[model samples]
Target: MYRTSAMKQYQTVNIQAQTSGASPHRLIQMLMEGGLSRLAQARGAMERGQIALKGELIGKAIGIVGGLRDGLDLEKGGELATNLDGLYEYMVNRLMQANLKNDAAALDEVSDLLRTVKSGWDGISQ
Candidate 1:
């Protein structure tokens, strides 16, 4: 179904609720989930030739990736943090190209990278 106003409103409320109760680890998980979702949506929009929507979704995905990068603890996380920062930057760059070129393959590549990162994150004992 098409996104209705109510759907958007509900999503906002739901995210607020999740964030309020979530721990830092859970929040990271949510960000990964959101990034993946946006990439998929953006890809669909590209396939459908919805250029504007694709741009909007890709922008949101980039922001989410940037947020994740910003949240890294460089001092405490050390080399892992540095590596992740590089990966996030690469993802953001690829997303920009995907948006400009409407390349679904680039979107898929980013999505795969996110999934790999998310899997590593999910393995941590929380």
Candidate 2:
């Protein structure tokens, strides 16, 4: 399960699970209501390799629907596993960068991505 805590600067959200699991569709709905456009912009950056983790370029971004429904264990679809991993890492990097830069806009982009993924998971559950 994911938990959220209020912080002085920003809210701290943590996903706790033995393995990474897919999110629910309602997450997508929430994202659409929040800022889907920003998510698209961030996605563009990802495609352009603008987003990096540990200074390494992200090569791909996978959008597999409910791929991780079983658990954190990865179930590859096509050739997207590696790219999805990179994208996930890149988002983590973006989150850190946004926090350090005090960029609310950047953080919003990441939030939207999370919501989309969660929504995909929700679809899987159904």
The Cα local distance difference test for each model comes to 0.84, 0.39
lDDT of 2 by residue, 41-92 (tens): 5445644556443122111111211222112334644345555455555565
lDDT of 1 at 72: 87
lDDT (10s digit) by residue, model 1, range 26-123: 77888888889999999999999999999989888887787787778999999999999999989989988999888999999999999999999999
Q: Which candidate's TM-score is highest?
A: 1
In model 1, which runs have C-alpha deviations exceeding 4 angstroms?
Answer: 1-20
Residue range with the least summed lDDT across 10 consecutive positions in model 2: 5-14
Give one clash count per candidate, in the order shown: 0, 4
Instruction: Report the alpha-carbon TM-score of model 1 versus the true structure.
Output: 0.86
